[model samples]
Target: MPGFVGAVQIMNIGSSGVFHIGDVFQLTPISTAKTFAGAGSFNTGETLTIRNHQSATNTFDNDGIDQGNNFNL
Candidate 1:
């Protein structure tokens, strides 16, 4: 799911379930979570990504962003 930076934005998440980067943001399994601080369970091998707007270039920084790997479940 190749998406342009800053081109996409999350409007909302439904009540059926919570949203995740890979689930709602249309990101790949390896992508890291860029926003939304929370403690939620995820499956193993699952990954997520988020944008880091605080950077100078406003680009997606792999180090600045948060990542979830090696899930407990």
Candidate 2:
């Protein structure tokens, strides 16, 4: 879809924009703490991975934080 100003199409109007970080990640630490890319390790209770927007594993199937886990621990 494109909206034109008479003859010129506008650039990305409602896009989510480029990802701030370019790294595939999964939910680590099934219990205590976790990191984005599983760079750190914790007790593994449950885990799921989502790359860009969607995931086949459907991390939401269970009750746990599946996104944005980068605390200064």
Using lDDT as the measure, the top candidate is: 1
For model 2, state the Cα shift of residue 16 in Å.
Answer: 1.4
TM-score, one value per model: 0.18, 0.18
| Model 2 per-residue lDDT tens digits across residues 1-73 | 3343344454663332333223435433423334243322234546745345542332233555455536722
Candidate 1 residue lDDT tens string, 2-71: 5445555779754433445432634434333444332332324656554454534344556853545656
Give the local distance difference test score of model 2: 0.40
lDDT (0-100) at residue 68 of candidate 1?
Answer: 58
Which residue pairs clash in candidate 1?
31-48, 31-49, 32-48, 32-49, 33-48, 34-50
